[model samples]
Target: MFTEAQLYSPVTRTGDGDVTVHLSTEHPGVHDPAYRARRNAIAACALEYTSGAPTPRIAYTEAEEQVWRTVSIELARKHRGLASAEVLAAARRLALPTDHIPQLDEISAALTPLTGFRYVPAAGLVPLREFFGSFADRIFHSTQYIRHHSAPLYTPEPDAIHEIIGHATQLASPRFAAIYEAAGAAVARLRTDAALKFLADVFWFSLEFGVLREHGEIRCYGAGLLSSYGEIDEFRRAELRPLDVFAMGTGVYDITHYQPILFCAESMSEIEDVIGAFFESMDDETPLRARHLPTHANVPVAQ
Candidate 1:
């Protein structure tokens, strides 16, 4: 969730280089006549996060420290709640030194041993390809900051707590970790705009906002939705949807509001099964894609 527009705008180029859609974050704020006088022409919202738009870095405000502390402590405690076989238990093993707040440095020191990839502290969102490409190498694109507690059950944006405490802990499971890496590799190679959007759906619905089904019971798994107080109760026992045996269906998810529906997999092994299907479903031809496509390919670019 970025603070405002007029600093960085998402400008889409049409067939001949005409501006299509834009969520401007120009320096002038929204007071300029172009935005204020021509109010109806004002493009998107203040915290616009579209599939193709660049994910802006959100440097946590000075006021957010206390909230970060609250969430972190809770999740740290949550690591103990899961069964010894669960991913959270693995995260407990991966938990390294925290310097006041948990630094990416500390987290990586633990993760680097298991996987070649490390955590990268970022501002807002990384480009879609980079987000996946980093993962392709096992590197995790993480936001270095946390969301305030009052943030409507945690927005879909990957905040600091969401990354380090929420998602990184789950990364401890090698199989789940590999699925993340392979999925990133797939997204990196898919290259087309439509494919990237589909990857975003994977990240959103599964990695960030996914659930798991053990026996007949469903449980929260993904951090983006797990950090939420609003969603946890609804999805845990709810049907959500019958999960694809592979990571097939999470390719076109929606954010900016509560997810009315969720998707659940039976296990991490199931996650691998779905992702393996993703590989089989596509023919490799990513690099050939143009940087500036003439049309939307239904793939998402930025997270």
Candidate 2:
């Protein structure tokens, strides 16, 4: 499973209103001090935010808005045909701005009524536990910065685009939101770090990068695929395998490149019945007990 630091900028808050980001050198635009400083400032503003407090607003530059616009328009087109029905419906419900970057609060406001999910600011990496555990309360930790202007359609790590467009939209759906909550609860119940890591890996394959077959067509439900301009179209080309918890949890791959393998579900019902049920039933002893159970007993039961 992916770690917060692997996917986000590192955020640190020194005071009530003072937040900073230590951008990784591997990240795009990291060599530009001005750009790095801008990221820090935006994250700082987000740190000052509290529940019910007005969301921190950033005056996005023309370049930043352009990045949002380009990706939003292109991804919208891809989504129309390739995204899961639940995602498309949720995206419509959210009705995110395409001309400019929508403020985090704006997205949260739209999502709250639909699923009670709200966005919180992250300077960079949110601890894995806090990041996933927040789902139990329907809160999502997000970054405020856009991807580098040069690659409006691509980001080395998750940026505002991935957080809002990909995840916020998904959270708008009651079905998906319920699954998220289940996953969070499972995380909280797991006593061993190994179990937690296993759970996170399962989430990685099922929610962050999972795929599904809908009405004879393969569709993307994972945020990582849905928000990606380049990778969304390429996911179908990967080796699509059955959704297996063990393989998903143990498999290792490079994050920097397009995924070469993906887990596919037969349908949305399979996702809920198998993956969702797995989350709802898991605890600290689940994994350990499974290890001792017969192999057939551990396989996904017929839905």
Measured by TM-score, the strongest candidate is 2
Q: Write the per-residue lDDT of candidate 1 for residues 1-303, one digit (tens) a residue.
A: 211122223444356534333324422323344433222221222124333344433333444556666655654554344222366656666763333455565677778777655776554545767766777778776655443334523443445666766667767767667767777667645746655655555556777667766555555667654455455545554335545422333233335455655666667677667644554344344212323324332322221
Q: Give the least accurate 10-residue stretch of model 2, judged by summed lDDT.
A: 294-303
Over the full model, what C-alpha lDDT does candidate 2 score relative to the true structure?
Answer: 0.83
RMSD of 2: 3.2
lDDT of each: 0.52, 0.83
Error of 2 at 139 (Å): 0.8
Q: Give me the candidate number with maximum lDDT.
A: 2
